[model samples]
Target: MKNTLIVLSLLGSALFADAAKPNIILMMADDLGYGDTGFNGNTIIQTPHLDQMAKDGIKLTHFYAGNSVCSPTRGTFLTGRHHHRYGIWTANVGHLPKQEITLASMLKEQGYTTGHFGKWHLGTLDKVISSKGAKRKPAENFAPPWQRDYDRSFVTESAVNTWNPGAGNRAKNNPFYENGKALDPDDPTLAGGAARVVVDRAVPFMEQAVKDGKPFLSVVWFHAPHEDIEAGPDYLKMYEEHGEGAHYYGCITELDEQVGRIRAKVEELGISDNTLIFFCSDNGPEGKTPAKRRQGVTSGLRGRKRDLYDGGVRVPALACWPGKLAAGTESDVPLSTLDYFPTLGNLTGYEMPDARPIDGQNIWPILAGEMDQREKAIPFIRGNEVSLVDGEFKLLLPKGELYDLSKDWSEENNVAAAHPERVERMSREIAELLESFKTSHAGADYNDPEFKPVGKWKNVGSKKK
Candidate 1:
């Protein structure tokens, strides 16, 4: 009887251990320039929270978003597959398709409580239609409700209003809200615009998850420093003291403060050691043109948000899970948003559905310090333009601009003329890969004809846009 009781007690302990899994919080910044953070060598802006997070966690120096824009990158992050695979080529002001599997849905299968706060550009249900009270339109390219796949979600159906200077759209009748509660947009006590709203919602969600003793996955996507740069009086005044760089610098500081709040809350709940936090930007900076008068830089990379260049696609990424990832470690291996699905699956021991073809690979070994090699080349496409990076040699096709990324991170020089053999081999590889892509919709055809050859296979050199 003594031996039997001891065996039963051990079995109970094993079951309890199996029930506990790490909570995940993914935060994405909108239009955050690569050089805007202190760790990335930004002299003007102050991001103490992010800088500290980098110091306490693993920093990904060579992280690349799935796309150079907003909606597509989010799509890739959630699905762990290339955005183009699901017809999400760009931010077309619509929803994701119903058939595609998302991270939230997969997590839900494993008894995880999933919630998405902030920008949900993926799709909306008919009940939360964007048309106020009017009859629903023909749905157009909108994603069906099935695609959203979240237990609880709050998202802006349109571009968030960050343009209204002193008063940043957080009124009682503000369009950005969930369940009829107006989000605090210009609250001096909170962060700025959309970030303020996300933080407020996220705090309570984290509290509730701890109470319920369930592993939670929350995605907070902030719409700040995107456009119409709006900074509150106090934040604006702080930057103004620093002279000409106030407006841009102030917004970043406000964002950092909000992140600090969330971090503090996680610690307050005594879950900092068990929680995993992933922070990154959807893409590079926007509003760099003269007409916009935007004060931002791409850290010396070429092109802006819309272009398929490094400035557009490359972004800062950091991950922290106390006691799991080594503090202050930095990984220079190229990583993409698509890898999140398999990595999470491996970590939690949840079986990801294998119904469809997934382009991303599991990076668990890399994060666990067991492996150092990234075996596959990342493929990128925007309209007719395509690019493939095999290690340091990035072959930009049709235009056939080859840049040794190891030496030229800015993409200023075109060495395709110098390496014809390399260009030809990469072009043929891209051609064979493109053949496998299923282009069922005419969306790819509805692009600016001028940009068509940008991703094509050809040999051109010494050109400027």
Candidate 2:
């Protein structure tokens, strides 16, 4: 309790810090689980800085990703709208359309320098890599970050080994790109833990923006604890006792170190009070089965990634903006990465246009501790499986298994049998929402003739029969 007072007092002191247009930092983890960080009650992993970051701001108890997987969720974060509206139904399926006005583009227009660092699964960043006599077909998938209006960027199109990213087997061959050029095998950061390189590029970008006296929007998406996960000897040493799975836990700590680095830089630059830093995972843990050795934990949640269950969609979310947020406070109000666009838009005075359909609500009121309940229900869709959640009541579609999340967060109880009217209503709502996905899937959302959906793409896990 004493600690809480100290933190709160510090936050109060910064309530009037210089930030009419605050700098924003959005950080995301790949395949990180709901209960994997120190702030999220994972005692085994050491994330001291992240836990303190949460204490200095708000920890969202019921935060969710835009989607359960990578590309779709990323697309959702970039645009204020859901990914299905833009044809990226699954990872590696479709590119982020040029027509979509992304948060970076919006902030760039608002006099903010925008940069993206780390994994950019929204689209391929290159044309091709030719180790063989023939070339691969990312040439057909080229939509680099510069084209998306990111002023600067250092990113890989997809996942890479967390340790020693550049040298690897065929699957770990994703190149690290800076702007439009390759990172030039000589770059030292290319050989380290994934987060190390990510922050290496990120800090400089923020520093440049600070030097220019411009508010910046930096998206640092780390590919740690994802597939092909590995930890350097240094990070692995921190978890020497976890045996083979130590790689997962160790790399997370490494990533946390970078998080700490970012926070310290913000403070060092005297911008901590005016900069909003948000951290979250893209989804729940990877691999339901033990042998996947992903070693990811969802605390005691019911499902892993790629499901309609809460564990699949719920993620650990922390937001810290010292000037405007109370310290050590938590809000159970449902929030989504989809809300970042609208919330930041509202704070920065970029009004959402009336013509475009956006799913996110401006959650600045909730972040400021003035609101409790979310204004709109959060709809979770993967292929044809849809889950319509109106507050605690989650109505799973197709079979209508209803669960009150407030009572059974693990989702062990199906209350649909007891609440017929609720089931019928939420089912009707899910059906209506599914029709929206179908309309968007049919390319109705694309006003540009150049925008194209991958016609033959299948979700692989789509339950749509």
Candidate 3:
């Protein structure tokens, strides 16, 4: 039988290389900063396609943004945990809790085809939009994104108008919904630069999930230089010498021309080496100072956008996958965005279930340079403010302050009195990790008692059982 046809052609070439997985997209960038792009150096923000997608791959210099704001760093970048365990403790408060477990419902249970598009501040894309007599109550955050698994959505229940985004009062009170309907408030493709109307509905949902052969995830979350930030008139005449910082550097060079139109639609669907593409910023840069349309800059990194420091939880990461990451490399470690759901559940072998408390680790061996540091230790919180960081120290908490971020990377010297036993061992490990994030914020990692614990539980550095 010719050795059983060479073991069934090596098991059909290992199931065609496990069904040729990687086609993720992830890209975020609202309230972006860490020196708003030119791939983190920002030489006057032209962002030649995010400086050639960080010179064609992997730049992630000490990334982060698992919460310095924006819906608790987008619910710890889709549930690798730590968005105050469940109650998304910030920015338009709590929501995304249909018994949490996302990254588009675990990559739509690993067959993928998820979508998402722009600015879904993690809930309330209209279940009859009426937080009547407003104070933002949209039916206690209705949780959309096509009911949180998103096999296609075009979202936006927050911040519109980075130029004509369907006209005014925050786009007639948070418009653009699609896949759960809403869009037409005169929707002529919602006109112009809101990152090219969110990559014109994310390039037709990555060309209909590569014309239905599947494998996609495309969560392109841009709202470019957030707020009512405007620019169009040729991206404000291409920043004519930055007067009023030319609409925040022309709405971040019109969101870096839709990140070069999603890297030229993954090299025109040849699927640029299986297509990975990540990017960052959901925090850091919305101003405590630099105004005139808040010219967001943090290359000096101290504090911005609701200060948890390091310019409000770092930012500006990048990735890309043309033949699996490695052009003009750079790393710095300390990644986050809560390691994008356990590094895409360890690059699609998928098994991410120990039923909760997954504060994001499997960083694909720190993005395949095969690790150097960071083996967990990146906690933080707001409204009572606590911090941690760990290797190469950080601490902070109720102002106990420490910082040796490899010899004060602008956390300006406060050795916590020359290290009182490393601040009593990271203040008893941030009080036993804020009492295991207050027992996963009292829903004990859900078997859903209808997902309880709705907001305001800031016990911060822990204790008071």
Candidate 4:
């Protein structure tokens, strides 16, 4: 009887351990550069909270945003698939099709409460509202309000205006309820100007999940330090001491404070050990005047926002899961925001819909130090331009510039001519991938004009040139 009782107790413990799953919180900052946070070796601005989070988590040195721009990067995060697959390659255009499955929808199936607070630039139209209103045709003027992605979402009509910095153009009637009443549009606390409103909504939602004893996934995407830079008084003071570009620096400082609050709340709720927090930016800093550039920070990488250079796509990335990920350690493996869906699904035992191809792989093994590197290369595309990477060797085409990233981090030296064999192999591989992708979006091109190349690369090394 003693032996049987001991065996039964062991079985019960194993079953309970297997049932435990971690809650997830993903925070994305708009237009935050690679060198903005102190952990990335920034000495100019104070980001004690972000710095602390980096210290407590595993800092990802080579993590990328998947795309070099906003809307598409967010799309990748939600789908774990390439944004180009859905024809979402830029910002403020259309909605992610309702047919497509999203991480939020998948998590909902696993009994997780999901919420998205802040910038939802993925799609402009709200299907719930559009279906009730007069029939509107698809055009530049008649765009949707929100993507059919999340179960509960508080998203902006467009990127929030940080210049004038007020809550303008939010959906009337609130559509979604808060405290049994529609949220007040003019309520300064819920305004979309700074990080406060998004953080405010997120904390309460998380607290409620705790009370309900349910696992939750909350995404807080902040629209700050993006454009028309503005700063609050308290944050302004930090930049004032620097005596130049105080406004831009102040905005970042304010963002840091909000990050600190979220971290504190997790600890207060005693969920720090069971909650995984992943923080990153959508893209790099937007190019501006030197004064503005002084306020904006990058990790000395070439190019700014909207470009395919390392600086544009490779922004700061950090993940903290307390007991799971070793504190104060850094992983140099290249990881993308696209991997979030698969990673989260694996952690929560949520089986992602197997109907469509998933571009992201499960990086949990890499994160847990089981694997030293990814087995396959990651591919990126924007318009006709494409880039492919195999380990440290990267071949960027349409320009056909090749660089061994292990040696050249800034991409100043091109070795495309030196290694013709590598160039041909990668180019052919990319060509085959593109051919397969074209067929996937054949019927639904939306007849939008083909993407035109925008920066210096278009003139210097493009096939058009």
Candidate 1's C-alpha runs over 4 A off are: 1-19, 124-138, 141-147, 163-174, 179-192, 241-245, 289-293, 439-465
Q: Per-candidate TM vs. native? A: 0.82, 0.91, 0.35, 0.84
Clash counts per candidate, in order, are: 6, 0, 0, 6
Give all candidate RMSDs, comma-separated. 8.6, 5.5, 22.5, 7.7
Q: Candidate 4: deviation at residue 419, Å?
A: 2.1
Writing each residue's lDDT as its tens digit, candidate 2 over 323-431 gives: 5789999999889988888777767767544456677767776787755677767887776677777888988766668999999979999999999999888777766
Tens-digit lDDT string for candidate 1 (1-465): 334433443443343356468898998888887777887878778899999999999888878888888878888898776666555666643346555567787777877888777766654334444422223221544443234666666555434544342243432222444533434545443334446656777788889989998889988887667765666677778777655456566766777888889999999999998888988888888765423325667788887787778888888889998887899998877788887876676566655444465666666556656556566677777766788877788887667789988899899889999998998898887776565444312233223333221111322222346
Model 3, 1-465: lDDT tens digits are 334433443443343356588888988888788888877787888889878888888898888898788988898898878888777788886688887778888879978889988888876766556322155677777788888888788877777878878887687667788888777768787887888888888898888888989988888888888878888888778787777779989988888888898889779878888888888998898868777888998989899888898898888888878666687898887888887887786667666565677887766555656556767788888878788898788888778888888778889988899889989988898788788878888888776666668676667654334
Clash pairs detected, candidate 4:
124-144, 124-145, 125-144, 125-145, 125-146, 126-145
Residue 255 alpha-carbon offset, candidate 3, angstroms: 12
The stretch of ten residues in a row with the least summed lDDT in candidate 1 is 451-460
Candidate 1 RMSD computed on C-alpha atoms after optimal superposition onto the true structure: 8.6
Clashes of 4: 6
Q: Whole-model Cα lDDT per candidate?
A: 0.68, 0.80, 0.80, 0.71
Pick out the ten consecutive residues of candidate 3 with the lowest summed lDDT: 4-13
Better of 1 and 3 by TM-score: 1
